[model samples]
Target: MKLLLVVSNYPYEGHPYSGAFNERSALALRRLGHEVEVLAPRPYVPRGLSRLASRWSSYASIPEHETRAEIAVYRPAYAQLPLLGGALWSESCAYAVSAGEIARRHRRAPYDAILSFGLIGAGGIGWRLGRRLAVPAAGWATGNDVRVAPRSSFGKAVRRSLEKIDLVFYQSAELRACGAALLNVAPDEMDARRHAVLPRGVEEPPVLSSERRHELRRAVGLGEEQVVVLYLGRIAAPKGVFELAQAMARARERCPELICWMVGAKRGFDDSAKLARCGSVRLIDACAHEQIWDYFAAADIFAFPSHGEGMPNSLLEAMSTGLPAVAYAIPPIEEIDQGSGALLRVAPGDVHGLADALVSLARTPERRAALGRNGRARVYAAFLSADRMASAARRVAQLIETRGVSFSQFADRSAAAVRR
Candidate 1:
């Protein structure tokens, strides 16, 4: 099957971590023996330009082509300020325009189906294109789109887009329900039969030698015998960075040798500096995705006290590296289960509970190691192996080919029945 995968974000030189999960899914689909072409609208901001000139130059600047994991990828230019309002509008318009061009070019050899990620921005484009081309369209809903955006006008527009798509993929049951609710559609209308829980995947990281681990510890000013807790990803409020800091401080008082290393970028360094005053926390600027494995391998544990998520890729990466995770027991986090790692009941802003969990993990190395091994096993069985996802994609493709129904058609039929 020939598939056109559309998304607003893609891995680029400056933002390699961006849209990696989408890229991984595309790779898995290709590995399933399907031909895949990624249609991405590369966003650009020209510096000190004649505004119109800047937009034109930025659009022209995008590479016409690229390859990722043996799949052909094309990036068309889109002029959008990265600000919230303009970005959303720009993405919708750019995708609609670019997708039409793609349809025209491939008119003689039309794509078998279209798969899109995100609802408000990317879904509008896919729905318009699929309607134009008379092909099946599927949309994947990320956590923020469902949980955070629904209260806004843009979010309502996204719900309309979802209503027009054939299938909505979610990472968890809660998210699926949220999507259905936002659309004001019955849960059954958003049937799990068509929907799927497709969590992200990660490659196993390289095994670090004891010497390498010790070297990393020394470089970070952590003692060889200390229990090092590592936090990898953005250091934002939603990420529970402040809570993690408090937890580290508490853990330090109990186990003086416990060290916390935060390896990620921060919008502000002031918070990190405040945490450093506790004398047990250190913050390093973000590391390359390729280099993240070493930090996981070197650390005794991975701690993320984030409040909400849609199956975070970082958790999977940590598990793949046999690093035990201590995270807040949010809906997506519960997917890890007891067999995978420790899930603590820390409310979104519960600093004390977060700190206590860290201390407990630090004191119990044997339990931590066991948890890490279990997490690795769980990841291999359920998340890391892309075979199940490939099977699901193939099944969806087969349905699209056999039914010959556009997503909007299915949605309209379903909605009509509901009204009747």
Candidate 2:
């Protein structure tokens, strides 16, 4: 089938780490023998007054372009001025304009289906464009859309759009619950038959021999005997970086040989000073996505004390590489089960509990090794393989073909049925 994949945040040459999950899904679709195209709305600041507003805020402009990846890509330009107390009126306007462009293009070459990522402006834009082109459109929701946006007016608009899409692809049960709550629909009315839990898959990394592992360790300045706990991703607050630092500090008191290597860029949250103060923690600025496997192989264990997430790709990648994980036992994470790794009950701000878990894991090498092996086995059997995700996508597409109505229409009907 011919498909159009839409998203605002896609990885370009300039930003290779951006929107990796969506890229993985699109690649998976292509592997399943479907012709796919990408439409990314490039957000930019407007000229003059809008540029000033963007300098102050960053919602004043949008840009557009086209590229070829594993599939054809289109990046439409639009204005996104942040005004009226940080509203996204420019984003809405950009979507309307881009949707018109997409419609015009589709008239020349029609697509069988439209798949969108994000629940806010991007999903809404995809829905509008699909309607104009008379094609089935599905939206994939991650953590921010469900967990972060609900507190804002933009979130309300996104919720309405969620109720209007053809299908909803949620990565976790928590996200599904958030959608149901936002739409004021019953939990059961969320339509699990149409909605699917499809986490992105990780490619099999090159097998790292013991020599390669040791070489990588030396290159990264980690000693052979040190028990390295690795954290790979953006160093942000919701990621629990500060909590991980506090945990490492406590663990160091017990296991002096333990080392924590944080390999990611600093973006959302600031914890550099806190981590620096800890003698055992080492922060590596950021590595290429392709080079992530080396870090995973060099580490003894993976530590992700995240407070919020939607099936973090980092954890899956670590597990695929046979690294044991010690993470906060949140809902999306709870899906990891106990066999793969140790899931500790560390609430968002519970630094003490996080510290204790790290300390416990640091002292038990046998437990760590066992968990690591189990995690690898679990990833291979359940999550890392792309076949399951492709099957789920196919099922969602088939549901749209059979139902004759969009996912949002079905959700609305389901909501009404619940009320009756």
Candidate 3:
């Protein structure tokens, strides 16, 4: 099958971590013997305005086309205003600007199906294109689109998009319910045939010997005796970086040898000054996805106090590396844990509780080892990339086969229902 994946976020030049999960899925689909291509509409900012800010500069720098993991990725430029509900209209802007190009490509060689990530943004593009091309379209609902976007100024866009796309894949069951609520429908109304969970997969890491682990720690500037707690994600407020800084300070009061390393890009929420006050926290710039395993290998524990998530790849990667996790007890996190006791859960925004959880994991070697074992087992047993992707490929095939026959009729009914 030939598939077109439309997503707003995708790894681009100098920003490899961006949209990494979406790339992984495309690669996985390709590995399943399907021809996969990506349409990632980058936010366009002119060269002069780009010079004024790093954010705009990055957008201006994106190449029109690039190949990642042997898949062709086309990045068309779209006008992206940074203010006044620009985010809510990004999908419409992208579709409006790039639809002709997409139609031209379809005329040359048609796509079998279209898959979109981020329901309100990319999903709109996919739904519009799928209708024009008369192909099956599936949308993926990640955390922000369901939880955060629905509460924003253009929140209704999410419900409208969800209603248009019949097949929606969620990162977790909790996220599915959240999306269902946004649609003003009971969770059960999101029938199994229409909605399902398709989580991101973590590749299992090779076990490191004690000597190699020590070498990795020293390479990252950590001492042999220090208990390392690593946080991997965007250094933004919603990701709980500020709370992490405070929690690290409190944890250090009890265990001075506890060292926290926060890795990844610094976003709008700059916590560098706050982290400096913490003293024991080390802030590392985002590195290639390939290099992250070294940090996972060196860490004694993984800390993810993120306020919200749709199956965090970092937490899963850390667990796959046999590292214990201490995280905020959000619904998605709890759904991932599934009562396995593989994680030490703390209340949302509770700095002291976060500190205690960190201390508890840092001081107890036995508990850490046990949790690590459980986490590793859980991830390998159920969350391997190959397994998850294989399941997703099968579902996509089913959707294409079924939806192709009745999409026009379904569209008519959906339009009538919405009008009524």
Candidate 4:
């Protein structure tokens, strides 16, 4: 099947890590023998005048089109309103700009399906574009897209788009339900027969031996007997970075050997100032995507206090590396809540509870080891690789086959969308 994938964020020349997960999904599809073309919208300014332009000028250096790992990617610059975090209307303008580009490209080689990597920004765009192309359109709801956007104007747009969209590709059942509520869809009607779950997956983790673990720790300047508790993701308020810093101070009081190492970039929230107060914490400004696992190797536990998530690549990668996770008890993380006692979860915003969980794991090596093993086993059994997500193309093809292909079905779906 041929796919025209529209994503709001994707890795560019200056930002190799912008949307690594989306890139991984594309590569996985390519590996699985599918023809995929990417239409990723980037905010940019003129190159020579970029320095004098707004904050979004950082992307000015990236070429509009490039190929990585043999996959064609089209990065079109769209007008953006700087500093308006969730400026709903800005996304519509961006979508209009990207939709024009996709339509232009469609004239040369028609695609079999259309899917958006993000729900709000790209999903709404896909809905509009799909109606024009008369093909299947689907959206993916990651953590912030559904969990955080509901009740906002963007949420309403997503809700309306959900009614029109032919399918919703989700990360978890919890997130799928959230999308249903946003769409005002009845619970019983929300099914795989309509919606599907595509949990984030990881490449098989590199083998780590006792000596390799010791070497990785020494390389990272970790001392012997010191337990490393790692947090890797965008530094955001909802991620509970500030609470994590406070929890580290409290947990260290019980297990003096415990140290918190936060490795991520300043996306929206920069808790570097708050984290400065904790002397036992270590900071590594976002490392390269290829090098993240080494930090996991140097760690004893992966303690992520994130309040909500679609399906965390960090949690999946860390678990694949055999690192036990202590995260917030959110619906999306429910599947990983393995009945085999794999994960330790605390309620969101419970700093003290996070500290206690950290302390318990730190003081008991056997318990940590057992949970880590269990977590690794669970990840392998379920989310083994991104290749699993590549099946999205097949699902889209199936939808096109079962629901719509000719003018009559397209007109029917299009009219239904108009009524919604």
Which candidate achieves the best TM-score against the true structure? 3
What TM value does model 2 have?
Answer: 0.86
Q: What is the lDDT of candidate 2?
A: 0.71
Question: RMSD in angstroms, all models?
Answer: 5.6, 5.7, 4.0, 4.0
lDDT of 2 by residue, 1-420 (tens): 888888867776645667776787787778778888888876555456654532333322223454546577777666555456332643466575676556656666777777887776777776776666656778888777776456587777677667777778787778888888888787688777656677656665578688889988888677877888889987776788877887788878877888788987543235555566656567877666778888887888788888888877788888877777777777877786643443334565677777776777777878777877877787787676366557656765685576455445444543343233
Which pairs, if any, clash in model 4?
143-310
Candidate 4: segments with Cα more than 4 A from true spot: 44-55, 83-91, 148-151, 267-269, 403-420
Pairs of residues at least 3 apart in sequence or in different chains that clash in candidate 3: none
Per-model TM-score, in order, reads 0.84, 0.86, 0.91, 0.88
**Model 4 Cα displacement at 63 (Å)?**
2.7
Candidate 3 regions with alpha-carbon error over 4 angstroms: 46-52, 85-89, 148-153, 267-274, 408-420
> What residue runs in model 1 are displaced by over 4 Å at the alpha carbon?
44-64, 81-88, 148-151, 186-189, 204-222, 266-280, 338-345, 405-420
Error of 1 at 208 (Å): 5.0
- Cα shift from native, residue 30, model 2 (Å): 1.6
lDDT of 4 at 379: 86
Better of 2 and 3 by lDDT: 3
Report the error of model 2 at residue 338, Å: 6.2
State the lDDT of candidate 4 residue by residue for 161-221, as single tens digits: 6677788877888888888787677656876666878775777788777787798888768
Ten contiguous residues minimizing lDDT sum, candidate 3:
411-420
Q: Using lDDT as the measure, which candidate wins?
A: 3
- Number of clashing residue pairs, candidate 4: 1
